[model samples]
Structures are given as structure tokens and as C-alpha cells.
Target: MAKNNTRVRWVSIGLTALIIIAGIITAFLQAQADIEAVNTKADAIVKTSEVMKIEGCLPSRANGNNITRIDTRLDSMQREQRTAFKEILRRLPNE
Candidate 1:
């Protein structure tokens, strides 16, 4: 009877310690996984924002170039009309 009691007590203590160690390891692994997931999500968000900014800026830059071209054409047309008007007025005065 004494032999059984002592062996059983030692076995109970060993099992309890093993269970606590396993729980601690599992918790640490879970925390590491959660931190990695959050970091991945943050990086994605930043990349998406950078892409959107680039896309948005390009269209406005194109629009500014288009505006400049339109202004140049308008100036050329105006000069042509002025020259034509001057020639017509000269002919009418001579007649």
C-alpha cells in the first residue's frame, strides 16, 4: 500500500507540470500568430494607399497637359483671325 501511494503522488505532480507547460507554449504561439497577421494587414493597407495615390495623380497630370495644348491652339486660331481681319479692312479702304 505505501509503495502505490508514493508512486501515484509523483505521477500526479508530473502530469500537472506537463499540462501547464503545454498551455504556456500554446499561448505564446497564438500571440505570435496574431501579431504576424496584424503586420501583414498593415502592409497591405499601405500598399493599396500608395497605388491609389499614384493612379489619382496621373489623371490630373494628364489633364493639366491637355489644358496647355488647348490653350496653345486657341492662341493660334486667334492670331489667324486677326491677320485675316486686317487684310479685309485694307482691301475695303482701297475700294
Candidate 2:
């Protein structure tokens, strides 16, 4: 009976030790996963910053030229409209 008790105690101790080791391993793995997540986020932020730098805030040359062309065309249209209105006013009989 004593021998059986001794064996049972050893088995319980072994099981407790295994449980503690598993808990420690689980904690270590969790910490590693958290670190990897942070690294991945940092990498993504760096990539985004690089993209922003390449794209820039201001319009490209082609876009700027197009905007200038549009503005000139609008000014020409406005001048034509003013001339047409002046001609119409000259044709109208004075009261």
C-alpha cells in the first residue's frame, strides 16, 4: 500500500510539472505571436509611408497642364458669351 501511494504521488507530481511547463510554453508562444503582429503592423505602416512619398500631395505635371488648359478654355467661353450679350443689347431698340 505504501508503494502504491508513493507511485501515485510521483505520477501526480509529474503531471503537475508537465502542466506548469505547458503553461510556460503557451505564454511564450503568445508573446511571440504578439511580437510578430506588431512587426507586421510596422511593416505595413512603412509600406504605406513609402507609397505616400511616391505619390506625393500635389498634382502631377500632366494633371496640372490639363487644369490650365481647362481654365483657358473656360475663359475663352466667358469672353465669347460677353460679346454675344453686347451684340444683342445693341440690336434692341432704345425705350
Q: Which candidate ranks first by TM-score, i.e. highest? A: 1
Model 2 segments beyond 4 Å from truth? Answer: 59-95
TM-score of each model, in listed order = 0.57, 0.56
Model 2, residue 38: what's the lDDT? 100
Model 1 per-residue lDDT tens digits across residues 1-95:
99999999999999999999999999999999999999999999999999999997898787874777778999999999999999998889554
Native-to-model Cα distance after best TM-score fit, residue 64 in candidate 1, in Å: 5.7
lDDT value, candidate 1, whole model? 0.93
Q: Which 10 residues in a row give candidate 2 its minimum summed lDDT?
A: 57-66
How do the residues 1-95 of candidate 2 rate in per-residue lDDT, one tens digit apiece?
A: 99999999999999999999999999999999999999999999999999987777445654764667778999999999999999999999999
Clashing pairs in 2: none
- Cα RMSD to the true fold for all candidates: 18.8, 13.1
The per-residue C-alpha lDDT of model 1 at residue 42 equals 99
